[model samples]
Every structure is written in structure tokens, then in C-alpha cells.
Target: MRLYWTMPDELRIHYKNVLQKYNEEFTKGNLSVAWRHLERAHILGQPWPREHNYVHWLMLKFGIHIKDKKEIIGQIPRLLIGGIKVSLRRTAS
Candidate 1:
């Protein structure tokens, strides 16, 4: 969900660590690992505002050839408002 203020320091650090891991995986051409890390980050529920920003940064960082970053980001609103659900879709077909 979309947090609108600063995240807790611990959660922020956790997210950054996840981002770093994701970037490392990307550099190694390990898309699967990157996806797994991103998914984990998403489930961590750190905070809304920072989490939204992180997701955007992640999309830019990892979704170069994928055209659904905006759609994926949009889901953040749903997540924030509705909580996690089984129907969440990160990529647009």
C-alpha cells in the first residue's frame, strides 16, 4: 500500500538492502532472482510512501524492456487501499 510519509529507519534500510540485492542480480543477468527479491520487498509492508517510491525506482531499475511499470505502480494504490490480495498483477498483458 502507498505510504505517504517517511518510513521507519529499519524498514527503509531493509528496503534498500532488497534494492541492492535486486540490482546485483540484474547485473548478473539473474532476472529470476531479481524478481524474487522484488516480490519479497513488496510483501515486507515497510511503509506506503517510501514503498511506492521504491517500487518506481525498481521499475526503472529492472523493467527496462517491460512496458507495464505504470500499471504495476498503479497496483500499489490497490494494495494500500485493499491490502494484499491473490489477484495482484504486476505486469500487463
Candidate 2:
């Protein structure tokens, strides 16, 4: 989606932090974490986040409008690789 507003450097920083947390929670398959981050981001004045952001949050929050096939299936193997990195660190410990 298109960003509708231009703000101060601080707001930009907040946006980046929110986006980062969103990615972190999304990759961990934690919808609650994702939603909270979005809420916080919105409170901080971020706008029109993104399709993936809203889609994943809605799927968890209300469990509605989740019907339809999408063209982008996401990178599962990438997630698997990230998981492997964590697993390897755990095994080492």
C-alpha cells in the first residue's frame, strides 16, 4: 500500500521499529504479538500498514474474511532456514 503521510524523522523511526516488530512476530507465527505491534504502531501514527500485516492479524484476531486463494504463498523455506538457525543454537547450548 501507499504511504499517505510524511512525518518527522522520529515518526519514521517509529515506523521502522513497528515494521521490524511486525516481521519478527510474523516469522515466529505469533499473531498476538503481531497485532499488539500493529496497535502500537498505529498509536504512534503509522498508516495503511500493508496487506500482509492486516491479513495475518485479522486471521488471528477475528478469524474472518480468510477465504480466498492468493498468488503469493510466502517463503516457507526461508522460515525453515531461520528455524534451523535457532534450532542449531539450542542444540549447541
Candidate 3:
């Protein structure tokens, strides 16, 4: 929200853990597990614009890697506007 630099330490730790897990699972070809980690990261990052956008970007790349037309298409908008929406919502609140 407001592009603040202060992310709670716990959240930052959890977010990094999820991303690391996602990478590990992806490396092992555990696509489903990787997706789950990505999803969790997405939830964890919702309040931070850069993190949210980054997760969406990773999701988009994942979709492309898996050749999922729907996910790839779906993530485009989220990748483009998800962060802006979070900032706007926070400002409104």
C-alpha cells in the first residue's frame, strides 16, 4: 500500500520461505507443490505491491512453462494491475 519499505519480519520470512519452497519444488518437477507454494506466496504478498506483482510475474512464467493457456491468459491482467489495485485499495482505506 503506499509502496512502503517496512514489511513485517515474520511476513518477510514466510514470503521468502514460500518462494524458496516454490523453487525447490519446481526444480524437482513437483509442479503441483510449486503451484501451491506460489499460491501461498500470492496470498502472503497481497499487501505489498512489489511482492504481489512479482508473484504474479512468477505465476505467469509458471503458466508458460506448463503451457497452460488459461493460467497464462489469466495472469496477464493480474501481472499488469494487481499491484496498482492493492495500492489503490490501501489508499482508499
Candidate 4:
């Protein structure tokens, strides 16, 4: 199994805080707020493969929870390719 590790500490703190907000809002049934947090988490983690993929996975789950076909479909490609893109960007830089 390929193990994806955590992001650097600078980004990790903010990424984790955003995910924490996502969880809290999701638990409260505040879906829009939860999605907003997810987007923020995605932005914060965009440079790291593990964090990027993890956020997309969460997005996929959220889409399924809400039964949104568009989001579910969208997240699929993101989940699969986002980490690859991040890795490539890091390598090319």
C-alpha cells in the first residue's frame, strides 16, 4: 500500500482546523457551512498530495450524504487526480 503522509506543519494546522469546522457544521446539519469549510480545506491543502486527496474524499462522502449527483461525480475525478497533480507540481517546481 502507498502511504500518503501529512502536510507540513504550517499548512497542516490550518488544514486540520478547517476540517474540524467541516465536521462540526456537518454534524449540526449545516451543509452549506460544511461545504464552505471543505472548500477552504481544499484550498489550504492543495499543495500537498495527502491533504488534497483526503479533502476530496471527504467531499465525496458529503455528496453521498446529501445525495447530490453532480458533487459525487465531481469529487470522483478530484479524488483520483488531485493528489497526482499536487505531486507533479511539487516535482516540477
Give residue 16's error in model 4 in angstroms. 0.7
Ten consecutive residues with minimal summed lDDT in candidate 4? Answer: 1-10
Residue lDDT tens for model 4, 22-62: 99999999999999999999898887888888899999999
Off by over 4 Å in 2: 1-4, 46-93
Candidate 4 yields a Cα-based lDDT of 0.88
Candidate 1: worst-modelled 10 consecutive residues by lDDT: 84-93
> Which stretch of 10 consecutive residues in model 3 shows the poorest summed lDDT?
1-10
Q: What is the lDDT of residue 3 in candidate 1?
A: 23
The local lDDT score (0 to 100) that residue 18 gets in candidate 2 is 84
Q: How good is model 4 by TM-score?
A: 0.90
Q: Each candidate's lDDT (Cα)?
A: 0.61, 0.49, 0.91, 0.88
lDDT of each residue in 1-93, candidate 1, tens digit only: 432345578887887798789879878979889878887777654345347545655655455545567756655565454323321222111
Query: Candidates ranked by lDDT, best first?
Result: 3, 4, 1, 2
Tens-place lDDT per residue, model 2, 16-66, is 788688669867878678767756765554233232344334333323322
Q: Residue 13 in candidate 4 has what lDDT?
A: 86
How large is the C-alpha RMSD of every model relative to the true structure? 8.5, 14.4, 1.7, 3.6
lDDT of 4 at 35: 96
Q: Residue 71 of model 4: what lDDT? A: 90
**Cα-based TM-score, every candidate:** 0.56, 0.44, 0.92, 0.90
